[model samples]
Target: MSSDEIALSPSSLAETLRAGERVRVLDVRNRDESDQWPLGGGDVETTHLPYMKFVQAQAKDEIGDLAAEFDDGERVVVICGRGESSATVAEALREHGLDAVNLEDGMRGWARAYHAEELDADADGATVIQYQRPASGCLAYLVVSGDEAAVIDPLRTFADRYVEDARDRAAELRYALDTHVHADHVSGVREVADRSDAVRVVPEGATDRGLAFDAELVGDSDELTVGDATLEAMHVPGHTTEMTAYRVGKVLIDGDLLFSESVARPDLERGDDGAEEMARQLHRTLHERVLALPDETVVAPGHYGDDADPEEDGTYTATLGELRDRLDALSMEEDAFVDYALSAMPPRPNNFEEIIETNLGRGSVDDDEAFELELGPNNCAATAD
Candidate 1:
């Protein structure tokens, strides 16, 4: 079969999955790698079959195992580390009359296709829209109140979409804020600011990060007001000394300070020297400052890892009571908390340095180059073990 007929673009594949259509995803990675970081989204069914085994069961150099697992003409998307190997596998599967297609650019291509799900509705004063970059679990928020809106921790590749979101909501874009100088995807703060007339806001503590652009700095007690929405900035200096979480009514834009399922790693920006100190700061930030908030307060954090599933209500959120009851990180004593926080972490996200530079306005890349630099899921959390 020709390459054109046997290849599925990531866009088309994402659409199929989002539409709740049945499409079997055959991942040809080694079994261990799949176990370590499984590919999952919503309810999509994925199967792991190492490349060698897949070809070994083929009769007379033709695919038989896949045919046995799936009916003839069943749609399947084959994926490997890079885009190349999957094409070969798709070609092999097609010889057996299955409608197999190679996933374009493989997993990396899939990572760049971000989709948003609105988190707040029908409640009271304001609303929040969550942009979930499913693969990396990097989340951006569109917090709206009356006629004004705030775009926080926007992903670099999807900045314009946020501006469009503001327009769609019939709100004037008032502020573009970053939780901290991100070490994952590029920050779209400048993109949001440049696209509209919004002001840029960063943490007062970001002086250490040496951001190049001018911005209003907010620290604990300093608040940002947009119409009836008053977001109080809380200086929670753990993940980064500069990371800020905004208090909007019951919602805390918790940044990287806390996650609904796990805690942020402390070693990324500090390297090895300041691991202990960073962990201590993180502990205090969670215990002394953040834990003081009301138990009913809802936390909306910056990034999420692979296993987090949004609630059936379509919101990725948790109350202080829920997190306090469920989150293991909250129960640790000072020393254990520090030790756990300083433990081994996953490898940094791809092009993390470049992403920080761009976010700081000290570096630039073309759109294509930016997307290439940010082609995979963000490894922004610590390893479970």
Candidate 2:
């Protein structure tokens, strides 16, 4: 078969999953790797079988018999750490008359797969584009107005996507902004600035954490203009000491401060020894800063949990009023809120320490290394009970 006929792009698989089509996935990675970060989507069935098993079966001339276990008349999408091993297995399955295709570039490609949707909210004559990374539930935004654009919390893997997206809209990428020093993934702010004429902006609080990059440092209530639109910085430190949210008209580009179903884990910035105090700070920020916004203000968070459901428009956003009513942590007293924020947190994101260092400009990594470092679910939020 031709290469195109035997290969599936990650974007194509994402589309199929989003459309609720039934898909059978054959995961050829080891048990630990498969269990730690399983593929996720709607109406999908996944079977985990290490590639070594296929190797052993092929050696005994039982490849056909082995393929029989997965030849249930449906196309199987095979995946591995990278696409190399899976391609061999997929070709073997095809030789046995089963419809099998390799997931191009494997799980790493899936992690790089991104989707952009125009948000259904008022951006004061500006367009708000929500970039969703389904693999990690990381969310970023692009605000465009009058030939000028700014990106908030972009991932390094897709820095070019943001610039290309801005150019396609007839807008110049004016600003690359980071809400905080991220711990889950490498920040694309520096890369975006290097690729375009955009100015790099980071929170002033980040300087305390040894921010080694050259950029404009914004403080509380600072405003930046993107053509006719205004991005007003609101320093709402909690998840991290530098956590900031940008308000573009009625849409709030809130960082890890809040999410659709859960709140940010405060311990990422400060270890457990200082987590309680950070949690207390988080509670105050929620009530005095976030909840203070108008009920109609659309809250666009930095990350979404697996349980988060997108709105009818396919954007992971909610109004301040809706989140206020839904999140129990948002309504609790200070003491209770702090306790809730710290209890039952999921494991910190994989390679988070190194990721944070790289994001802070204290360390450097090549593009491939950066992509590999963040190839897992972004556990940036506290587990909701």
Candidate 3:
């Protein structure tokens, strides 16, 4: 088969997985890399066989034997770090009479496999599109009303996707907003602004974190209009001192302040020295600012955990009342909440410091470098009971 015919694009794989078609994946990346962030999807089974094993088997004239191990009736999709080695392995397996296909661009491509789900909730006459990055479980949003659109918490890797999506809907992209200076991935606020005539907006509290970019700073209770819809900025600092949430109709474009399965980790910005204080602030934000909304307010967080099941409509969202009842930390006292927020924290995101510098406009990386930097799980959430 031709190389093109022997390869499956990440989007195709995503569609297959989303459709719940049974798929078998042969991951050929190193053990550590595979263990750190493995491919995941509904009804997809994965088997890990390091790429070096295939190379050694081929060198020993045992490629046939190696391929025989994966000779099940199902077609296997081979994946590697960048897809090149996996393509070769897939071709070798095909020569051995096995149906094998390489995952185009491999895990990096998988990281870029972004899916957009239309939120089935009221947005004050606006259409809400939730952009889900499965590889990292990062979520961004696009809100369109009348003729204007705004994108929140966009990733630099898919900046153009947001612009194209907005234009496809016959709407002018008016605003590119970020909840705060992101530590997990490079922010696309600048890229979106550069691509369109959109104004860049960041929380005014971010200025305290040495924000050097030129953006319209929004303070507490600040409002911006998209067509006929109003986006009111709520300064709800917790994950970081600059974290903010935007309320549009009944939906809140809440950044790392909350998630479906966990709350935001408070140490990313200030580390251990200030984690306690930040945790307390986060508690206040949850009780006073976030949970203060009506029970039916749709809380759309910026990220979702691996175990977080999406709603029937495929959006990772929960009502304020639901989260208040579901998360134990939300119901805890101030001291208990702080202890829960700081206990059993996961490792910080890969290359977070550098990503933060890039997002802050204090450093720069080429497009390829930026993509490579944020390739792992976004360990942005704290452990929640």
Candidate 4:
């Protein structure tokens, strides 16, 4: 909270970066913790270091090597869930005779302070794709084709930028909607679609209550070619009956059905029903369908929220070849995966109902209204299992 003081608060760290100061973000949380809840991207350069591991142990032995990675006198801002762990790391770095500043309030405070940015607009060429890293743990995308682009879960006002990006890319923005629905920040799919002349496209089997659209009612293996890429619709129902995965080339746009590597939480919609359903579906999909693809295919998933393991973010982009070799669901018998999934799930966010309604054009709020409600990055959701 202090400015002149050498130590920095997360809010102040944000302010300093805004002022064009160079700061290095050092995360000291454990590998698993970082995976579930990471610090979202913003105005600073961040380097991750799991607490008391090879990276940390080596920091002392190679202070010069570590210091060489940074500019002379660059303020090193270390962080973790609470300030204590980061503070300790900073002290060690400082004692090693390097200029470093511990980030006060740490990761939690950072999530509370800085806002996420929309990096690429018109991301998927003429289709107009926009990317958002919201609530530290969640990643949402909006893509448009012609006068119609689909919005998967949206995180911030970044939705507006997504629309603008579509315009810049010379596409007529039409439809906005999520893959199934969401449990994190209220989905702004409809909020954004309404901002333009777009309709909302709910997956064919999802709940429908008279929403207007160029209804793209699809079934298993049905594919839609938007812009230059083809998004194949795979009806892999486990996380939810309506849950679908959109595949383009080797890249699978796996909504909550698949994460960087792990399948998404199934407990939200089904509760106890979810655990059994997810396990069964996961076994079939992973062993028979997904893993059946070429090992080199790339995988991009939906819902990387507060529950993801941060240490795995870089490696999150796993190849079909790699995923097949490493997937736990594949090795486990169906019953085991069901039990494991139930035990691993975090509580779904308290705002899922609101998010679903909002995405379905039933909620009462604008994009700005929803963005303000989700300023802090918290993307953890516990489903029905």
Candidate 5:
């Protein structure tokens, strides 16, 4: 809506990071929103300031505070879930005489362009887990152990490359996708499964994607053994009814529900009433369930966005403690949080209906058709939560 802002391109952010300039990143997304997913990048200096706080404080009022910690003319990058909201804040900061720029493309754009490090599958180097971010914020996991591995949530566009990466790791692609149904991009799960006939496991609750054979419909606490690495599915049904988080060693594959510093959208299933219930469920899971786990767990989320990191043109992985401290909605009173979440709901994915139908065996589209159906920058939510 505002055009007076100077938004930094992903390339510029990368350059700044490489140059080792003194930069401070301001994240404008709410805390609860950031908890489930976070920006991607193995490197980037970031700061978190929810948009409402930025809007209320005004850059002029905050410059003095930052000046106490930073020198004038030092680079400052501002970001939100998407780049739109942060663009407004960046303009305000620039007006206040600071060298601030919005990270163009945001976490979503960066994910498509960067390579992130992976978690160890066994806490031992014997099993290695690697991941790549592509197609906005969708994270593809390559779980390797004993010359065999599998990928999770691989987007259609990266399907071939994902297979190649597995081979490069000297692992046969044996299994994939046993977790949540994606809302933003159509998944390569069914395609990969169909292509290699690898065992693809999904939850029984998935009625949307008409997924085919060698599929195991798992439930809460169900354990999936992948080359000595055990993946335990923890059913966390807030983002979608079928949303499931994977517990692989000390890290959690938090599907859309949790981020490194944010939470994914919870209204993908339609109905404001349903979304309200989901918000409550998410709160319970965050405080009662996830919090109960060991605090040191590394959180690898399903989606990461542009605003997750402003200094780098990419999003990244984060620890559980980082998210619990941010993503504000997760900390609010249940009713109020639900209201906030629903009020900010963005338009659902364009082909969500088709994706659901195809996953549920109700719709039929071939591989090429699926790729066309799946590829795109995610525009569903106005900003990341």
Candidate 6:
């Protein structure tokens, strides 16, 4: 079991995953940990084998069952919560004549491997940068128009990186915006604004949430300038009462109000009783506010999950027409759609209350606490199918 270092960094593993390499990831965390923070995607296959079970098998010296599952020739990688347990498991697996290497830094490392890529905006004068937090299903954007720019739904942890990207694009940071009162991740709008003298704009209804700190509040048809381009605000609720989508040229920077596969759930702030009412509002917002737009308009959502719209660079986006055609569920009758939303509501994201408080500036937590609250892919997309 003793040997020199045998580990794969998250980035190296990500490269292999992206290239469609036939790598098998053996996640050696317990059931609860694996369920809460599952890994392994792209072209990599994952098998859950708890380290404790593997250790017990090693103690018994009857490795037949364990040995039969994995091929000796295939590239097998071991991962734990943070790589400590996986190293031991890898060592044990190696003793059984299997080529297994521990994943360096494990799931924590995976969380930080957010690949920020530029999105090709058919909007003539605008440059949109998509900050894809692959581990958490969070998508933030930096929209640059001429020399001015707007920052949207940014994470608090990556504030500096967003600023640096703005400088790299040579766009003067002018506006910092939050689509709504986020219930998952802390907003970077405050930091982004403080660093660049950018005016922070929250959706008009957000003021009703009793949030203390604020700058500008925007509502329907309210125009905000981004250099040569204009971003008109659309009051699209149902995710939250405050949900607003910004129309930048032909692109709808839709908030949690709409996603690629599913629309936002109605019961987070409302609970079950108010869900019906919220669902009705959602119907109006989509049928009246959002779907009323031209089919050519591009929908850039607040986040994306596994079944998101596919693209060459792993960016999640779709044209209104494409989605309207593909997602037949979106076109359901009003009564059916409301019933569907209420009935199909999934479990809320972990620590949503604390996350919402932090976003509202009513509660405060350090970086580590914030990270813990916002871990795993966002469950905000209602009925992920």
Best by TM-score: 3
TM-score of each: 0.86, 0.94, 0.95, 0.63, 0.66, 0.93
Rank the models by lDDT, top first: 3, 2, 6, 1, 5, 4
lDDT of 5 at 337: 66
Question: How far in Å is the alpha carbon of 353 misplaced in model 3?
Answer: 0.6
Tens digit per residue, CA lDDT, model 5, 164-255: 77778777777778467666666677677766646777876774434454467878898777677777788887777777777878777777
- lDDT for position 108 in model 1: 71
Model 4: per-residue Cα lDDT at residue 321: 65
lDDT of 2: 0.91
Q: Please, what are the lDDT tens digits per residue for candidate 4 over residues 1-385? A: 2322446866665455434455567777777666555554435466777777625566558755655665467677777776877776677677666667776766545644523333221134433232424334455554555554555555444557657766776765555645665655666555566677756555776654333334455667876656565567777766666767766555566666666446666666666655677657766776677777677666656645422332232322456666556666557777777676667565455456665566555666765566545534343322322
lDDT: which is higher, 2 or 3? 3
Steric clashes per prediction: 0, 0, 0, 29, 41, 0
**Candidate 1 on 306-383: residue-level lDDT in tens?**
456566556577788888988777889989988887766777777888887877778888777877777565766655
TM-score of candidate 4 to 2 decimals: 0.63
* Tens digits of lDDT, candidate 6, 27-133: 88998888776774466577888887888887898566686688658968888888888888787777778888988878887777666666665754788778877
- Worst 10-residue lDDT window for candidate 4 reads 114-123
Candidate 1: lDDT of 335?
96
Best by lDDT: 3
> Over 4 Å off in model 4, which ranges?
1-134, 142-151, 208-217, 305-316, 366-369, 372-385
User: What are the lDDT scores of the predictions, listed in order?
Assistant: 0.78, 0.91, 0.91, 0.57, 0.64, 0.81
- Candidate 5, residue 175: Cα displacement in angstroms equals 1.3
